[model samples]
Target: MQLTIWSALILYFCVFLAGLVDSAAGGGGLISLPAYLFTGLNTHTAIGCNKFSAACGTGFSAMRFFKNGALDWKIAFISAICSFISSFIGIKIAFKINPEVLKTVLIIILPVVAAALLLKKNFGVENRVEEISKAKAFRFAAYTGLAVGFYDGLMGPGTGTIAIIVFSACMKYDLKTASGNAKILNLASNYASLIVAVLNGSVIYRIAIPAAICGIMGNYLGAGLALKKGAAFIRPIMVIVICLLFAKLFYDLFARYFLGG
Candidate 1:
């Protein structure tokens, strides 16, 4: 589909916002997926195009985190490998499933996660010592990769948030480190999904190219802010993203099941 000037401009703005939020906290797909759908693409095509822009943004953020030495290469690498494989499988399954079913599941799940974060005041605020051995951390990281990566590929939203939540809560990493490491694994998941999208001819490059450029800029800026401000800056945005995800999922459910829009 060809993009008019107004559509292209709107997409740029939306993707930029997504990149910023995704880089700082996660759930950037909440913005980008809806924006793509508004362009009249079907769910699969919209998801494919979204992965293109989101992956670009995530790549930029991961680079910044790597440069700062905030990422644990050992964990990130293992997680990334697991994420790639799980994401590929998830995308394959997504091709056969109705997205409404996924939205229904998220509606039930996201609020609980948001509530948990809200109730735990000290969560991800500071770096915590590893509560388990290296072998255990590696095992936990692998599990996180498979679970969150599969979710990312199938639903294309809130995967990064899940990663951060697991990394900090289960792996005992600090928020900064968790966020940074999440970017790396998130990139892997996005790339894995993107490959499937490309093979299935779901992406529209005309829209994706400009949106990706805008997304890259936003990621760069957001990652910079997170690095400078630490968890204090990231935590609030994470909360906001979670709330937004919940709201978006609720709307999708209501529209499809009731309003039928």
Candidate 2:
């Protein structure tokens, strides 16, 4: 597809915003996916291209969070390695399934995700002692990695938010720690998908590089604010963004498949 100067520039502008939302919460794909679709790319190419672009921004955010001592590398490394393996399997499975099945499922998924977000305030930012054993913790980490990573490669919605929610609810991680760790795992899953995108040549480097720069800047800004204001601020944003993302997903599916507009 040929790109007009205006279209290219504007799309990159949107990617920057996507990165900001991604760093602060999750589901940034809500923005970047539509931008790629507007370029007339097919679903596969659009998703692959988005993975390539957003992975860079996610990496920057993960690094920032790590530097600030917000992450638990013990868990992050375990989950990341497992996630990478699971995502590879997931992409392959996605190729066989009807994409609309996933879309319809998401219509059912969003409202629940939204409700979960609403209840997130009860989760709290304070750290809790691990009630599970080391063996059990490692087991949970691996399962979460595989499940979420598969979702990342296959559908790419609510990945970060899901990770944070699990970290808190299951692992007893506080909100800030969960967000920080989730960003790292999110980077891993995005990178897993990007490898395939690069192989298939769906990504345009010209668009990706500038957008990545903007995304990195946004991460810096968002992470700075997250660090300052604490999870109380980030938590509300996570809930709202997830709800918005769910609505966007529902609308996209409804228009393309149901309304046929």
Candidate 3:
């Protein structure tokens, strides 16, 4: 498809916003994917191009996390490896399973998740990693990567948000650290999905390349903010991302089952 001037602007602007939110919280695809579809791309092409730009943006954030000492290298590496491998398998399973089923489940679960976040005022406020054993943290990280990565491959939204929550709740890292580590796992999964998109010849480089630049800028700024503000900043953004994902999934289910669109 030809990249019209208007389309390019729309893609860049939305992708920049997506990168910012995604870097801080993890549901950037909720914004970017709609923007691509709004620009008249088919679903497959939109997803492919989104992956390309997201991978690029996520890489920068992941590096920033690493440099700033926010990440647990061992946990990040273990999760990345597990997610990278399982994501491939998830992709294969996608062809066989209907993603709508998963969406239905998420719609129900998101509210409880959101309520927990809202009611628990001190949820991710402090870094509690000292309390957890090294072995237990690593185990949780691996399980998070495998389970969430598989979901990412199969359904493809809210991966980072879920990862951050799991890291904080289970591993007891603060929100900032969780967000940083989640970026590493996200980067791995993004690359895995991008490879499949590339192999299918679905990525539109003309659009993805320029959009990726915006993504990088957004990610750089967003990561900086998260680092500076710590959990106070990341927590609200995560809640917003979860709410948006919930709305998106609810709408899809509504459109499919009720509206018949």
- TM-score: which candidate is best? 3
RMSD of each: 1.9, 2.2, 1.1
lDDT per residue for candidate 1 within 1-261, as digits (tens), equals: 777788777878999999998998888998888888887788879888899999999999999989998888899989999999999888778879888887887788778877877888777777764567899989988999998888887776788987988898888888888999899899999999899889989898988888899999999999999888878888888889988888877876686667666
Worst 10-residue lDDT window, candidate 3: 252-261
Candidate 2: tens digits of C-alpha lDDT, residues 137-195: 88888988988888887777778877887877789877777878788788888888899
Ranking by lDDT: 3, 1, 2
Per-residue lDDT tens digits for candidate 3, residues 179-259, read 988999999998999999999999989888988999999999999999999888888888899999998888887877786
The TM-scores of all predictions, comma-separated, are 0.92, 0.90, 0.97
List where candidate 2 sits over 4 angstroms from the true fold: 99-106, 256-261
Q: Top model by lDDT, which number? A: 3
Lowest summed-lDDT stretch of 10 residues in model 2?
A: 120-129
Local distance difference test scores for all models: 0.86, 0.79, 0.91
Q: Is candidate 2 or candidate 3 better by lDDT?
A: 3
The lowest-lDDT stretch of 10 consecutive residues in candidate 1 is: 252-261
Q: How much is 184 displaced in model 2, in angstroms?
A: 1.8
Instruction: Mark the regions of model 3 whose C-alpha exceeds 4 Å error after superposition.
Output: none
lDDT of 3 at 85: 89
Kindly report which residue stretches of model 1 are placed more than 4 angstroms away from their true locations once superposed. Answer: 96-105
lDDT of 3: 0.91
